[model samples]
Target: MNTTEKVQTCLDFIDQRLENQAEQTIRIAELIIEDIKNLTAGYHQAMRNGNLKEHSELVRQTQLNWVNQLHDIILEQSNRDLSGQVIQALQKFVSNLNQTQMQHLHFELPSPVAREYDAQYQYLSQEEIELLMGQQRLFPDNNDSMH
Candidate 1:
């Protein structure tokens, strides 16, 4: 099959799965909504205590945790229900592509080995550092040397 046909077939498969899982999906959504309501209530109580500045940080952190949990739940569900089927379909799709078509295609799959980086590394190139220093010199009024 052509690329478009293959893609449409995969999408149709996903749509069918979604239809079958509609009830479960709705229940999961309701749970997420309830959690959001609780978070909002806590935020309001914190606001009323007149310690909003301090409490706001805590509220922000809690919201981030909730979002992360929601992401994990969705990923887990997708892996459990769809990963194998999707992998098989994709393998067939790639196998069907002609040599020229395959040469033109590019993919950026995640690699566990690529995750590590030097935290203390400098981000700016030498040219960028020089350009920034030049810009600083142009704004003499705001220069630290004046102080």
Candidate 2:
């Protein structure tokens, strides 16, 4: 198979494995493994096509570029609501990455959240909860069909 097809194949296998795992960290590890697999596959494909021989220099450069390109995709975090622990784990992974590895890939660190919640709720300032039914002020008009 070509590089693209091989990468997709490996990704499929990793995705299936992720489906069985319940832990978020395990899934992330699988994703990292999948990236390594794809990069290896790309190298193998280049060798198979005899392209590596005709352009040895080009092949080396391309391999470096390809590895970085693949890393870029794996580093992306889709959910913005991840907890602090999860974010820290990902950051550690990025920090430990080799210099060549991060050339093409970049990690988007999750925004930090408040470590503790305030004991006092803001509702106390209101003094009382009003149960005004059919009150025009609470519920605005102009209802759309979309809900």
Candidate 3:
């Protein structure tokens, strides 16, 4: 498929996934938050116990387990949301292009739409330039212009 078609397909798949998985993503996030909170409380209780070293070690292990669980949940949810279609599309696109052509290709940002009251036509006062100098001197003074 051509680049434009591939991009559109990926975008359409993403839109569908977002629509379907919005609720599930929010639910996963809530569950993860609750799990982390419970883990933190357990760790705090372990810290306060008589068997400091052993309890701390156990808590540390438990924290690692919780982290891994959280990671798995996020990965699973993301995979479900994306469904791997975008990755497949991009792979196909890359496989179709030649090495030299791929190397030379670059994306350019679209130019902003012109406004009737754009700042380019408005003159900055000397004080404004001085104040802006501390941040960024966007427009150089006419006196500083190289003629």
Candidate 4:
């Protein structure tokens, strides 16, 4: 597929997966939509400059942005499984672009090992003490562990 088609696929994937109407999700969705628009403009400029012939360069760049953003979100979510899937999707998308368009793309998949260092803490979705009372036993006492 060309870059345009590949970009659309990645955008569709993000829209399907992350376009939740929640406040935070909506903000992210808007950011991604704007990024896509910027990428489209970049591609048009590149084509005009004769740096790219196929529209796939734009698509690849768009997918790259998604993968990069997904890495950040995965870090925030600490969801290893989902992060791996995103990496795989990015790899396949890049490989397809490279093989089909003869355009080499460079990207670094987020390292889970690096991310794990920050995953040592607990992040709560809600501040309700009652909901957490029963789960107290599952965590170490912060006061005792500090030293």
| Segments in model 2 whose C-alpha atoms lie over 4 Å from true places | 1-22, 50-147
Across 40-130, the per-residue lDDT of candidate 4 in tens digits comes to 7877787788867455766776788788877776675554456457757876877686687654556543555535656655445456665
TM-score of each: 0.32, 0.21, 0.30, 0.28
lDDT of 1 at 125: 66
Q: What lDDT would each prediction earn against the true structure?
A: 0.70, 0.53, 0.67, 0.67
Candidate 1 lDDT over residue span 9-93, tens digit each? 8776866665666656577778778867876787788778887786677768767876886787688677646865775677576
lDDT of 2 by residue, 3-49 (tens): 44565565556555444443654565676577567656766777888
In model 4, what is the error at residue 103, expressed in angstroms?
73
lDDT at 42 for candidate 2? 65
Model 4 clashing residue pairs (backbone): 3-56, 3-59
- What lDDT score is found at residue 87 in candidate 2? 46
Report the poorest 10 consecutive residues by lDDT, candidate 2.
110-119
Model 1 earns a TM-score of 0.32
* Candidate rank order under TM-score: 1, 3, 4, 2
Q: Say which candidate scores most in lDDT.
A: 1
